[model samples]
Target chain A: AQKVTQAQTEISVVEKEDVTLDCVYETRDTTYYLFWYKQPPSGELVFLIRRNSFDEQNEISGRYSWNFQKSTSSFNFTITASQVVDSAVYFCALTPPIYNQGGKLIFGQGTELSVKP
Target chain B: EPEVTQTPSHQVTQMGQEVILRCVPISNHLYFYWYRQILGQKVEFLVSFYNNEISEKSEIFDDQFSVERPDGSNFTLKIRSTKLEDSAMYFCASSVTGIYNEQFFGPGTRLTVL
Candidate 1:
């Protein structure tokens, strides 16, 4: 079984401040995938990033970045110079690689982020 | 950009009634999935379908639930009998080939079982 945990239930920050949301996962499989998704107030999930376990390299996409640490079993997402649009519920998901069966996404409880101007 | 689409943005049904939710996955995608989220709760996986059959399903997907790719484009989820606990936002997603493929989700159908 694969499980993902996002410790922070809620976070608030002023616009332009940087924020990092924490995520930890547990999986016995040697190969797996980690993902970050954003659900805005409209209640639509938007895919953010996907990182395979083999690739520990950190990734940066415009204002968004992700750090994948295998030793700690953590995949954290950070937003730089956050704006009001960044206020949304962020979820971390895990997928086991052994079973190439239908792509199943085990999601976390999600972190609700609020950015104030 | 290509994306998945679901029908009936909101549906209100009485208890014990049957309901079917529809989805049109991306034209070129092969894998399809259904997930639901109750108010203030984490998203839960229900079922996954591929190659015109069910490939995997969660414990939550019991005999009461069924999925089918009726035609070339549509995928549908049917619930035998509605329950209050089933009232939630149901999402349909699709991905390309591999298990690691990033799934694209629809806006979701809000099912309200009365």
Candidate 2:
């Protein structure tokens, strides 16, 4: 079984503040991929980043960063100096290579982040 | 970059009616998929299609739901009988391959069963 859990349903932060969204995953497969997507008020999903299991390097892109830890089975995302436009529903996903064309993705419940200016 | 496209940003249909949602994937992509997200709920996978056939489906994808490519440029999802619970935002996605690739999604169609 492959599962991703996002315990925080909603979070609010003032503009320019930093926020970290937590993601915990459970999978029996040794090889897998992790992803983060953003869904704005428009209802369109935007792909943000993808990380493979072999890579545990913490990545930083612009004001966004991700931390992948195998020990904790966690992939956490951090937004530095978030702006109002950064407010969106963020989802954590896992893709295990064995099932369904090997392209199926298991998504978490998602965390709704609201940045107030 | 080319992105997947969907038709009718919003659709309103009565319960028990049949509805078809359409999608046009990126021209060079080979794998296609459909996913649905209900109000305040997590996005759920429905089905994946490749080689003009269904490669995989979730438990939610019942016999009432059918998918067809119809032509080289268009893919469609047909629901035999729409229920109130069928109301959701349906997203179409496509990937270059069906293995270990990122699947790009469309703007999605909001189906409202009244």
- The DockQ for candidate 2, computed on C-alphas, is 0.68
Model 1: per-residue lDDT, tens digit, A1-117?
789999999999999999999999999989899999999999989999999899999999999999999999999999999999999999999987656667799999999999999
Candidate 1 chain A, which ten residues in sequence have the lowest lDDT sum?
A95-104
Error of 1 at A5 (Å): 0.4
Q: Estimate, for each residue in A1-117, the C-alpha lDDT of model 2 and write its tens digit.
A: 889999999999999999999999999888888999999998899999999899999999999999999999999999999999999999999987745563877899999999999
Give the per-residue lDDT digits (tens) of candidate 2, residues B19-84: 999999999999999999998899988999999999889999999999999999999999999999
Enumerate residue pairs that collide in model 1.
none
Clashing pairs in 2: none
| All models, RMSD in angstroms | 0.8, 1.0
Q: Which candidate is the best by lDDT?
A: 1
Model 2 segments beyond 4 Å from truth? A98-102
* Ten contiguous residues with the weakest lDDT in model 1 chain B: B94-103
lDDT of 1: 0.94
Give me the overall lDDT of model 2: 0.93
Q: Score each candidate by Cα lDDT.
A: 0.94, 0.93
